[model samples]
Target chain A: MRSHRDFARGFRESLAGGPAPQNATAQDPAEIERRFDVYRNNVAHGLTQALARHFPAIERLLGADCFRGLARAYIAEHPPRTPVLTEWGGAFPAYLADEPSLQSLSYLPDVARIEWARSRAYHAADSEPIAPERLQETATRAGTDLCLDLHPSVQVLQLLTPAGSIWASQQPGGPAPPRAKEWRPETLLIARRGISHVITSVVRSSTGRFVSALRAGDTVARARDRAGADFDLNAALLLLVENALIVGAGIETGDES
Target chain B: MTLPRKAGLGFKPEHFPAITETKPDLGFFEIHAENYMGAGGMPHAMLERLRADYALSVHGVGLSIGGPDPLDRDHLARLKLLCDRYDPESFSEHLAWASHGGVWMHDLLPLPYTAETLSLICDHVDEVQEHLGRRMLLENPATYVLFDDSDIPETEFLTEISQRTGCGLLLDVNNVFVSCVNHRQDPRAYLEAFPLNRVGEIHLAGHEEEELPSGPLLIDSHGREVAEPVWALYAEIVSKTGPLPSLIEWDNDVPDFATLMAEAKRASMILSGDHHALTS
Candidate 1:
């Protein structure tokens, strides 16, 4: 009798296109092979469908056949580590980035990153946005030492291509996003707003730097200094407030001055 | 909490507006527990609104209850939280394993029906029930292969698990048809031996047929309407067990809300003993 552990191990191997387990039972060898094929197909198809659902932009960019081929390779290499299908494709962006054949489509990986972040933001825990008065009070009392805690769903991604625009253009009814004429980098802020709505914004590089600093627990003064003299601090603050990205704000307890 | 002995449809996001606005006469709405595991989102908001008017069945697809590894504590905690939030009328999981060594296969793989496997499943079921603070139903899997080391029948294995763990059975009629046809066994015999008295729910789903050299392989794709033979088996089970909380599941290529509701209406008519509806 095979141990359950051995059986699971063998079964997983078989489903990944390996030979059928020696202990697999069927009326005949031919039947066993066919059964194995069915299992393999089911696993492959299920994972492919999941990937397609999560990364629609990538699928749209690569077309269905190419995407399916890529999905098969990705599934074989990185079978899900968790039973949560929603959380299955975390490593896909990195996988695509590392693929030699996909190097030409350089923006594909960043688009995947944006999609993954959107998924995370969509399911992230809900929280009450920080009241504008609280932020004002912190700004008045702490001046440059103010630090803001972003919402749990807030995510920032800095990409080397206009992937954010590309993703937005592919949305169901979104207008055609302007094409990038040069190798210009873009930064995006993704967060959930007003109950269940997910919102994403492409930000100026300076604002992205400021937000990144604030997210890293830097005080307002330090973040501003890092964002450089040209950074419009008020505009960045307004953007965060309007999007309900900041969840809490307080004075920096430690002296970083 | 128990659901009404009528037919229901698996809840999908695309159909939420129709379900809410029209308020279809569904006995209950079944949702995949994993889909609602997120802390807060549209899924929860929609479910909350629907919960006001419909009984809910929290069906889990990733508990991996039949795996060799120990039950996943984090996953169980999340499931418990969801159950507490929804207060669903019923909770259920599959009998086949989907994960091992911290890697989830994303497909329900068959387990060897041995003493060791049976004991493990019973323990896992017990853990889930105790943690969730409610009894759960275990659904039989649609398996494509059998293990050479198996010593017990599938029905007997499920019966023993239920008897030991005090869990209820979720007899998926489509699975019965798919598995029996794949294994070249009699579907009726399997149903006859199933402990129908212990059943608390029934699942109906569509399957696809794949032709191989050996024979026609039925895949439990759940992407189309329920086949004729599966419907017959379901009608047969209903005759013996009377009306249970049956669910019509269409996960892939899901048609419009009206189409799914139509399927549910069909099941409801059957459950209500309007045999004419099945023919019509």
Candidate 2:
């Protein structure tokens, strides 16, 4: 009997575009290659379906056949390391960003990134948002020491293209995409509105800086300062509150006023 | 723990709203264990809702029980957490392998039936049962190709695994028929050799047929409703087992909730029909 290690290596190789495993057999000699192709087709077909589900916007941006070609290539080059299909496509955006064929669509990678972030946010841990009054009280008491805790699902992405709008336009009933000349770099925010859906949008650059600071454990005052003068702290706070992103608030120092 | 001996449908997220609103009369809903491995989300929300109203069978598609490598510790821990959270009525995984050398193929691959392979499978099953503190059902695999080195019959290999590990069997009738047709064996003979008393559940699904030069090659696609021949084979099993928890599995190109319920209705009719035969 052939060792399993050798068999597995051969099998994986065959699936990834190599020769059929020599030990594999069919009832008829003519059927060996045809039979072996079943596994190959399945691995390619299944992962491609998973990828399409993960990045529907990308699929729409590139037609089905074109998307499938890229999907097959991606599957061969960077097969998933885990069984969790949701987690399998994290590396896709980066892969897209590096692909020479997609250089013309510079915004494609960021669009993929936002989609990935939305998926991650959709599956993030659940937590209760701190009450509006709690934020007011914490700001008054802690002042510079106030540090806000964001919800587990909160994610901010700073991209070089108008990827948020691109992703949004691809969504059902979403607003139309910005004109090519009107397109500009945008900061995106993704958070779960409830268990059923995620809130993904392009936020002001200042708001992105503020949320990024808070997510990095900055004090509320520091995060606010990072947003600069044009930043509307009220709007930023409202965004967090309305979307249920602020889970808790605390003082950076152990001092409780 | 065994699920109710009634027909059920494989849960799809797209059917969440319909299922919750209508609350279809089902014995249970089966979900792929890996799908819920995420920390929290609509998957959990839907599952929690369904779990409150119906029995759940946590079917795993990624444990790779027949692999050469050791069972993934982190994956096993996640499975333990999910099982604990849901407290499902039944837990099952495939006898075939999926992941190997840390790369998940995402498709259940075949295994050579040998003593060495049998022992390996038994060990993996034992580990899973011990880790989860529960008995699990191991399902048969649908293979497209055979291995030259396989000396043991697939049925006997499964029987030995059950006898040694005390794990129950999940008889997937579609797989039995697909493998039988692919290998030019008799599905009835295969069932005769199967340990029917140890079968805790039964699965029926669709397959894609390709006309090979020698004969028909059926791939277990699970893309549509159960075929007529598969229904006949399932009836045969139900007649013998008196109605295991039969599931209508439609994974790919999943139809609407009504379509799935219709299929489940067919399976339920068979189960109840067999029950009547046994009683009267």
Q: Against the true two-chain complex, what DockQ does each candidate achieve?
A: 0.70, 0.85
* Pairs of residues at least 3 apart in sequence or in different chains that clash in candidate 2: none
Please give, for residues B1-280, the per-residue lDDT of candidate 1 as tens digits.
8988999889999998888789888899999998887777788889999899999999998989989999899999999898898899999999988899998877778888999999999999999999999999999999888887889999999999999999999999999999998888999999999999999999999999988676778999889998888888888889888999999999999999999888888888788778786686
Q: Give the alpha carbon lDDT tens digit for every residue of A182-246 in model 2.
A: 77999989889767579887899899999999999988788899888679988998888888888
TM accuracy, model 1: 0.95
Worst 10 residues of 1 chain B by lDDT: B271-280
Across residues A18-86, which tens digit of lDDT does each residue of candidate 1 receive?
A: 899878877656778878887788788889999998899899988999999999999878988877888
* Model 1 bad stretches (over 4 Å): A173-182
Model 2 spans > 4 angstroms off: A254-257, B274-280
In Å, residue B231's CA in model 1 sits off its true spot by 2.2
Q: Which residue pairs show backbone clashes in model 1? A: none
Clashes of each: 0, 0
User: lDDT of candidate 1 vs native?
Assistant: 0.88
What's the true lDDT of residue B94 in model 1?
Answer: 94
